[model samples]
Target: MDSALAVRALDESTWAAFAELVEANNGVWGGCWCVGFHVKLGKGRTAAQNRAEKEQRVRDGETHAALVFDGDRCLGWCQFGSPDELPEIKSRRLYEKGLTTLPDWRITCFFTGKGLRGRGVADAALGGAIAEISRLGGGVVEGYPEETDDRKVSGSFLHTGPMAAFEKHGFTRTRPISPHRWVVTRTVA
Candidate 1:
């Protein structure tokens, strides 16, 4: 809620914060790190393998998203990278129609701690991701958000942030990849 809250690129110091943010809020995916989709769908690595590789990537400063912080604490997580940066997303059916060479930034994942949910943490992260991408230079931003009919909270939901939430952040439906999946986009102009 504080406009002074800042979103900074994922860094080593913030790595623990990012992990803490997820573990404190959503334990299932948080426990494994944001490597589930990337590992299973992209690299086909075991969970332990994925964990080690992700850790190495962070150590190597190859992070592709920004961590949301309120003062010194990390409160949320968002993943952004050029489509090419995430080979797993391209291998998935949901992104089949999205052009790979367009130099687009894809928001493939997000997580907010339980106490921070419904408090606009995700909106701030999305805004921060867009700004980060735009700051680097205007590029198409894509996100696949889940279509939820009733705004009910579910503990099982992870990956693919809420469609309405993305819409609220200025993302529009670019395509309906499935009954519950929609590809949303916001072109920086």
Candidate 2:
């Protein structure tokens, strides 16, 4: 069997697939719709309200993420955008230390479905995300993959992805901001 991957912008036509990926793997990130790190964090807003706000971002062409697909099926997702584009990240307790606002594109989170875990889906998504950002005219792409001594960390908190996973895709940790988070970045050349 062949596995051809396609990465695209999150738009109206792709909304359902995006929603399906979140719903099908609620345990992965609690049916987040991938907005917790972009809209819900520290906002004190209900999930529904956060979802609504995030949906408006997509509609307003202000989305900072992309969904990954294996052919016609949505299998993974990556959240990337300018720091200013993501309110949740900016509002986090570690925001100042975890992120650097230097006109860079940030990859704050990633989620691949249960059946697709450990299958290089995240790597493919990362590559595709790089290409997406590069095609839009090259900028620094940053990630904050969680580092754990135990490999058994659950996907819910592993949304940042594994540090090894990011390293495999050319991301290098510039600094360690916390015990669980490290700031990683790749400057497109």
Candidate 3:
């Protein structure tokens, strides 16, 4: 971790920094605004609309994310919320195939700046999210991270994050969700 790294929750004061980071990355997964898991997918929405929706959620205090910062620059973030807050999983059927229960919170996605990819930004963000969740009230938090063997995976495809990062933060793998992804969890205390 960078010595200057700091983490903060997404709120009005930090919304601009978050927005700038997303905008720089071409709106984050084709102008997603990190809303793909929050709402239904494929609603034929434009990038601007997605941005508006995300901004509204932040303004309404209906979203949660741990934004990582290096001084004034926003490096990345980890998106997390209650199960109801983020219900749209990409592999829904597979994710629920053998599921018996839902977690108190889900760490759905992570994003690091374009130029800062391999600098432990996502790891720091994950740690921050865990700490924030713990402060709110300890509970079982779940995450879906990609499991890469000796194969190469694109950075965009690893948005959920890499399995190793989660494990490094004390998350344990529960089961496989997809061919290259696994359901991992950690009980914050």
Q: Count the backbone clashes (under 3 Å) in each candidate.
A: 2, 0, 0
Off by over 4 Å in 2: 40-44, 90-103
Q: Model 3 misses residue 56 by how many Å?
A: 0.9
lDDT of each: 0.70, 0.72, 0.91
Order the candidates by TM-score, highest first: 3, 2, 1
lDDT of 2 at 24: 75
- Please tell me which predicted candidate would have the highest TM-score against the true structure: 3
* Tens-digit lDDT track of model 1 for 38-97: 555344444455556666878886556767788888878678877556555522675576
How well does candidate 2 score on lDDT at residue 34?
69
Lowest-sum lDDT 10-residue window in model 2: 86-95
Ranking by lDDT: 3, 2, 1
In Å, residue 49's CA in model 2 sits off its true spot by: 2.2
Better of 1 and 2 by TM-score: 2
Per-residue lDDT over 1-189 for candidate 3, one digit per residue giving the tens place of the 0 to 100 score: 788899999999999999999999999988899999898758688889889999999999889999999998899999999999899886788889968899999999999988897777898999999999999897999999999886899988899988989999999999997899999989998
Flag regions of model 3 displaced more than 4 Å.
Answer: none
1 versus 3: better lDDT goes to: 3
Candidate 3 residue-wise lDDT at 66: 96
Kindly report which residue stretches of model 1 are placed more than 4 angstroms away from their true locations once superposed.
2-4, 22-30, 41-48, 97-103, 151-155
lDDT of 2 by residue, 1-189 (tens): 126777777777787787677667753344456676665455455556656766787888788566788877888878888767754552256647544465478887788887887666777777777887887787887787888777577777777778987888888888776777777888875
Clashing pairs in 2: none
